[model samples]
Target: MSIDWDRRHCSRKGHITYAPDEAGLRNRLHASTAVGTVWRCLRCGDFVLGEPHGSGPAELAPLVPRGRALRDLFILRFLAVERVLRGVLVVLAAWAVWKFSNSQDAVHQLFESDLTAFRPVADHFHYDLDHSPVIDSIQKVFDYKKSTLHAAAGLLLLYGLIEFVEGVGLWFAKRWAEYLAVVATAAFLPVEVYELTEKLSWFKIGTLALNILAVLYILIGKRLFGLRGGHAAFEAQCRGASLLEVEVAAGEAGGTQKEPLPVRQRSSTADPA
Candidate 1:
């Protein structure tokens, strides 16, 4: 009987060989290209040597992690979505600013003509026109200088660009993206807090909480800023679960002479049970 190398069985159970998916590989080694022809079990971080040779077993090289990977995936996906959403919102804001600025003259003319026509009627009703908040707000919009509106539009566009870059980088799971997200999110904490102080809402509270969580997750989970021994510890942890080390353990257990076969040969051969 031959072992089913292509089967989707647990590596810890010894029934099948398993390997980490690309995300898992990157997470464990910090560099996927360094190790060749080895994979880690998603469940136990054990290594499985070689690739599935045929249809004899189901393709299971990308082992599904039973624990941490799920959480990590959720967080990464959430941050990516959130950043993208923010980017879109800022873009809309920029557009609105540009449109509003350009149309301000027309708006002012219309408002003045309408208000002049309505003033006699309003006076008949004894309405306090000068004290009306609505009227004051409309007047303020008309008073905005062109240069001020242009500056505002420029700032919004720049903010949108930053958000778009962050979203794209995070979506690709880049390490630098994680750092940028953490910093950018943390920087807004004070503003969010101040906004809450001015006015409280469920939406604002939820956003603040999520931002705080994102920052903590990147800092602690990622071992940033020397937390948990920082980059050195992070690299060590990755190496500990790496495929090369796992292969050595697998070799000892199976009592088989382990050697990396050429890619062509490995793809063509099936292991005997």
Candidate 2:
């Protein structure tokens, strides 16, 4: 379904109204009615009743994210959530590995005794527990040196920390966070691909694909690394989305708000709804 990004944002954050000092801009933003004054919302471009939330020169107006900017924010936040989840899982895995390293001998003994007890059951079901790939895998972990286990845990913890930081940065839509995400995610692509080459799995492929997409989306969408006219172009695109900026630009171009800001006002005597 198509989403009304502007209205959806206004609904959550409340309407934002600004009174510009410029007469032409101010006239377009608000009007005096019999009941009260209604100012146009910069976020949704809807006339809102009551006083404007703020007043300033048109150039001093706040940059409010509407439309595509909101959508981009949503996408970045979604990636942020994914990064947080992965970070948590990785951290937990690191903890588990560290704990297992500490009690390696006890766990190994327990596994052997338990396997012995289950051997008869396995034979009854014609299952070969002795050479099972999964069993061998668990046994091989027992063979890892304590130092090796500790090193693995440390690496996992470091990775988890990176993911957590990246997630938090993206959640706030910081440009530096976007850069960090691109670099960190792209840096892991080779390792992920190598893992898939070693042991193919749908999960691995999906993760790799997601990482690649995230890198591309952030790198290109954000105009990073000087692509597509770089940061200047990006900032301009975002500025163009502002209702105030649009109107101010129009006025500067000798068109008086360029095109009239879309606004609906009740001409009736009924109090502003």
Candidate 3:
């Protein structure tokens, strides 16, 4: 009778076909028969297979999870710099708002024509001397005078709060955090670009470029922290291999009355005692 390989061991009967491994755990093909297959084990990271006789037969790639050991150090440096930059931005913005609010004389000087003539509207406000067509246009869209400092303060605080939250989430490798960071950073890009065009300064240009880089880094480099297609495939391959092993072991044990197969085991540097 032809030995039914299908009915023979754990490796043959699975939804996904596994290659044979000879150097598996303890190296016994089957407890009774010497027949077996060879494969690499992902768990133990070595050649794995049965001896001359064994029941379970499955092949797998040795798993070696790769990551930069110094990656966290780089990340720590990035956060430290970011915190300092954030503090400076807040301080500058706050000072600008405060300076613009209480300085009536400076406001008048801005509207003064040749340091002498005030516009017709200056008679009404006394400080409209500095008002120009640009200021007039800005006022028409949104007023930000001394009286509205409280409202402006609230808005600035809200903006800073959102940015701070995004930064914290990004540091933790959370998927939702990455998404939030991407959205928040992207939302500011257009406005930043406009500011860059309006005035080409080191500060403005640098801020715009930094924000753009942050957006791209979050969305592309990390795949939004594994919310992408590649991550799904990687996870699937890992889990699929695990499930295959379990099924093969159960199948081989049920099929024959022969003794369990012997397998070879190896020690690795990464393994713990």
Top model by TM-score, which number? 2
TM-score of every model?
0.64, 0.88, 0.43
> Order of candidates by TM-score, top first?
2, 1, 3
Clashes of each: 4, 1, 39
Estimate, for each residue in 1-273, the C-alpha lDDT of model 1 and write its tens digit. Answer: 744322323432343334333332233422233455554443444455555221211122332322343345446767888899999999999989999899989888998899989999999999978779889987997788988998999999988888898888776666678788888889889999999998899999999999999899878987887899986775555433434445444554677544432122121002111
The Cα error of candidate 1 at residue 204, in Å, is: 1.3
Compared with the true structure, the alpha-carbon lDDT of candidate 3 equals 0.47
Segments of candidate 1 deviating more than 4 angstroms? 1-70, 113-129, 247-273
Off-target runs (Cα >4 Å) in candidate 2 are 253-273
Extract clashing residue pairs from model 2: 250-258
TM-score of candidate 2 against the unseen true structure: 0.88
Shift in Å, residue 92, candidate 1: 0.8
Cα deviation of 22, candidate 1, in Å: 21
lDDT of each residue in 1-273, candidate 3, tens digit only: 643221222233221222344343333322332555553333322334543222234433221211221132234236435744674576567666656667745666564443454355566677653456766674443345666875665566667666566556545444465577678768878988888778789988887777777667656654445555544543343334342344446556776333333322321111110
| Model 1 residue pairs with clashes | 2-272, 2-273, 3-273, 20-40
- For candidate 2, give the lDDT of residue 216: 94
